[model samples]
Target chain A: MIVGDRKPMDEILEMLEPYENILILGCGTCVTVCLSGGEREAAILAGQLRIWGKKEGKNLNIMEHTIQRQCEKEWVDEMRGHVEKADVVLSLACGVGVQLVAEMYEEKAIYPGLNTTFMGYPVVHGTWLENCRGCGNCVLAHTGGVCPITRCAKSLLNGPCGGSQDGKCEISKDTECAWQVIYERLKKKDQLDWMNSYQPPRDWSTAGDGGPRKSVKIEEVID
Target chain B: MEADEATSTSEVPEEFRPRIVAYCCNYCAYAAADLAGSMRLSYPPDVKVIRLPCSGKVEISYLLKALEEGADGVMVAGCMEGDCHFMEGNFRAKRKVRHAKRLLEEIGFDSQRLEMFNLSSAMAGRFAEIILEMTERIKKLGPTPLRKGVKD
Candidate 1:
């Protein structure tokens, strides 16, 4: 799931000072699973805003609602009535959801309540660690299912870098060396020969470095 | 329902009783609470215990919700480190508790109101001590500013 963290309440309060009627929008998908911008989080944020507003005598009117997936146009459309009533929409979704809402409702003011951190899943209940960098290319086949692009500090392609000491990354003793993990896994699978092969340079064009990327399926689209 | 109404109105005490919510893991802390009961240890009645299958099941939202719903303080009691029934559930809960504390501090609340404790089922005495210690600490902190009738 896409992992994110709520922005500090101070910043959110500041952004909301200009608006009297605020809508706290939540996404029911990725952000919900990561425990960042879910329905419960949206409601809590609304409660917090109300407390702050009362303290400051702002007379803020806040409404809380959650959609199945804020990234989809249909789901966003379902919130049209509430959106139109709100002076400003405080989106608790990821960055994608915020932008999508802004694009869909061009005249309305949209603000992000969360700082979209990374594409990852919860390792346990509350701890989320990044696993994918969305580099547009996947090389997990040769690397024993461990992603160097996201795990390795330097994103080294071939093997362990000089900074790898005692199977830990040089960036921090807490981080395990990605290449070391790959090596151990490959050794167990008797695929150690894969390590000797040098991978070619990654294609930058397929990645988002060029520009905004899009995927289209003509068969699924209807005019 | 009648009893609840009586407690809320006619039976209301002049003294302020801090409302506390304790999320205890069923595998360890919950068992310890039961053991404390069997041993006949007396702890504060201010605390309300909610048991979960594992400490990791306790989410930050639940802790925040407790405060939002008028809890003066919230505590997470889990298994000792390296002793979680589900391997790293206690470690995960610790991280979440730390994160929740930071969030509370950011929102201008006393971060000490939220805490995490580690113990085994055998430590029934320690469990009772924790409840008393937390109750006293919260009494000093007074009602949460977010609580109704409490002014900033």
Candidate 2:
């Protein structure tokens, strides 16, 4: 899931200073799972904004709404009425959702309320760790399940660099060495021979190097 | 939502009294408040006690909504540390209170208006003292700046 963090109150307030009717749109997918931008968060932010407005003597009208997925057109289209009512929109979704909403609205001034952090999963109850870099390549077959591209500090194709100490990365003691984890995992599965197979340099072109990347769905009918 | 019927004590003027909401867990703080009442301990009437199953149930929104809806001060009272009936409920509440405080501060509101207290069910006198302390603190701070027309 794509994790996000709410932008500071100061930044949000500054962006909203000129607007009176504000719509706080929250996405219920990834942002909800990460507890950053969800229905509850949208409502909380609306409340905070209302309180701030009262204190600052601003006659602000704020509406809070959450859709199942802001990235999809159908879900965003359903909120057309609410969108049209507000003078400005504060999107609590990720960058993808925010862009999709902006594209759909075209004329409305859409602003992001969250800083889209990374494609990660919760390692613990409250801790999330990035596990995939979406390098446009699959190397899990050669290495273990761990992705060196995301977990490794250096993204070494073949690693356990000079900084791998006591199974921890050189960058931080809290970070587990991806290469160490890969080695240990493969060793446990009795597939250490795969380590001897050297991998060539990664191709960056497919990973949005030239421009934006897209995956078109090609439908096939049964003969 | 269980506020005292009396808005102010006999000495303080009604205008000077602050509207405080205290969320007390049934296992400890609520019991302590009850004991204080039975013992005839006279605390200020500014505080209104709302009972909860556990302090951990006090969500951040509740604290924010309290202030947003005209509460001058808010308090979350739970079991003493290491003595939570649900085991770690108070600890969770402590963290939530800290997070709420940060949120309040970030919104340019006074974080001092929100607080958390921990005491056993047997601490009747301590319950009265906590109320008095919160009441005095709020008195010094004055009414919440978030008050609708007053600030506007």
B106-146 per-residue lDDT for model 1 (tens digits): 65666777899999999999999999888888776666655
Residue-level lDDT of model 2, residues A87-139, one tens digit each, is 99999999999999999999999999999989999988878999887889878
In terms of lDDT, the poorest run of 10 residues in model 1 chain B is B1-10
lDDT of 1 by residue, A1-223 (tens): 8999999787898898789999999999999999789998897788667655543446778899999999999999999999999999999999999999999999999999999999987777679889998888899999999999899988888869999999999899989999999999999999999999999888767768778889889899999
Q: Candidate 2 i-RMS (Å)?
A: 5.4
Residue A32 lDDT (model 1): 93
TM-score of 1: 0.71
All candidates: DockQ: 0.18, 0.40
Q: Could you tell me which residue pairs clash in candidate 2?
A: none
TM-score of each model's chain B: 0.87, 0.88
The positional error of residue A154 in candidate 1, measured at the CA in angstroms, is 2.5
Question: How does each model score on lDDT?
Answer: 0.86, 0.88
User: How much is A88 displaced in model 1, in angstroms?
Assistant: 1.3
Candidate 1, true inter-chain contacts retained: 0.24
